[model samples]
Target: MAADALPYPLRLQGSGIVLREWQPDDLEDLVTMLDEPAIARWTPMPSPFDIEAGLAYLKRAQTGRLSGRRIQLAITVDGGEPLGEMLLFGVTGDRREAELGYLVGARHRRRGLATAALTLLSGYACGTLGLGRLLLRIDPCNTASTSVARRCGYRLTGEPPIAQAGPYGPTSLDTWEYVEGLPGPRRQRLRNVAARRYGRRP
Candidate 1:
């Protein structure tokens, strides 16, 4: 699929939520969500996540979208109440891969929104973008994220703890990596359906 043939986002609405692009106004809600310790502990965020930092990150996310390297979505109910955020980063064209990362607000945990949205996005990536594989990385300690990956049919390939830059300071983080592909019989059936409906071949 050509880049122009795909909708950069293509809003997804279901389960009383709409997953769409990041907006300047969303900074306030995101700031509040990031301020929660539940979200901060497992993910990488500044020690004291504040409004200013949130705004800056929002701007960077927009930049990432414009450059065609990333998609950062705001998870919200259909009526505009914010829930959380999810991101897909295109790692390499040669590799034909993208990485899935997400965080749900404390109040929205245990709902199927995360898994559902992820499933939809994974389909879009494969069907619309013609990607062969999607990579999901989860912090070793984040059982919720790991569970989401497993439930969505990603197979764990490795467990490696590596150092990466963080908001506060450099820290070692362990992550479990998983991959999704369209080669399997079940995935091929779904891909065929998407091709017929979306007018594109994956």
Candidate 2:
């Protein structure tokens, strides 16, 4: 399982956000998150995403979890209402790399929800899952997502944009990469009793 995908039906707690698998009760809220003009513009999520589309999406998400093909989570706070979605897909065979994507409801934007959720999930993917790299494909025009990716430590390289096939067919996107671990040495030093820890860049 470690080499194939994330732990099935995962749940994680962060400082202010929670990452969890989809549930039956989240159907309506799922619709709320995906069925928006912004979502349609930025994502390959089904257009006119209604209850029917939500049902299909729920089935797909659950099945993906069961098959260990990919993982998607509901982004929430205090385990309350579902406000957005975060997903890791296109996993490499060794599970050392994968693509990450997220969406927040229109009403829930501009509150640092995306940053909180992405930061939490990125930590899990690197630390718990031992992933060496996570990829984020973004359209340059979508400044909101670009900002979120940058804030969460995803960096754009000289690598040219690639065309990826999605539910909406092929689209060109900028590739942003997130490598595991912190970039610099530890700031605080322990005295003779202990050793200070530093992170290694992948």
Candidate 3:
């Protein structure tokens, strides 16, 4: 999608986190966090993170937003810190399914930021976007994220025995799948409030 096609603005919170679009200024922070050994260990990030890679990622995320392929947010606490990212991707033709992906900077782990962001974002997907299901592919060894998924109401479906490479990977990693979102009035209300708070049309 073209940059012109994206109309939604950044969404902010009183807690100092702003669910916002990618900016040129965020490249430095992205490089810093993505280069962390622990962050790179579980995630499919480039091993030797650099300015060029960060810029490229920003561009792709923006384009994905424009095309509706994904709705991505830069997770920042104390506002504008780019500590991590959360994404709703794999939107299909019917708009019935999408997958969730999240990565918090090693520094930001264990702070409930992931849970808060996931809850907020999941509501947005179901309420404003009207998606029926959200899937999560989690690394089995990452117990923290696994617990976060459960806390956010995702139910485990099963686990894959070995690693699975994504389209961009040379190797595969073992994964556990979980899903959330079915239709209901409670979900509608959550979406309504989120839409109003985030300046999205109800």
TM-score of each: 0.77, 0.83, 0.75
Give the better candidate number (1 or 2) by lDDT: 2
In model 3, state the lDDT of residue 170.
Answer: 40
Give the Cα lDDT of each candidate.
Answer: 0.68, 0.77, 0.68
TM-score winner between candidates 1 and 2: 2
Could you give candidate 2's per-residue lDDT for residues 67-135 as a string of tens digits? Answer: 888878898987779889889999888777889999889888899999999899888888888887788
* Best TM-score among the predictions, by candidate number: 2
List candidate 1 stretches off by more than 4 Å. 1-9, 14-16, 165-202
lDDT of model number 2: 0.77
- Model 3 lDDT-worst window of ten: 170-179
| Count of clashes, each model | 0, 0, 7
lDDT of 3 by residue, 122-152 (tens): 7777777777777777665666876787678
The collision pairs in model 2 are none
Off by over 4 Å in 2: 1-4, 164-171, 180-202
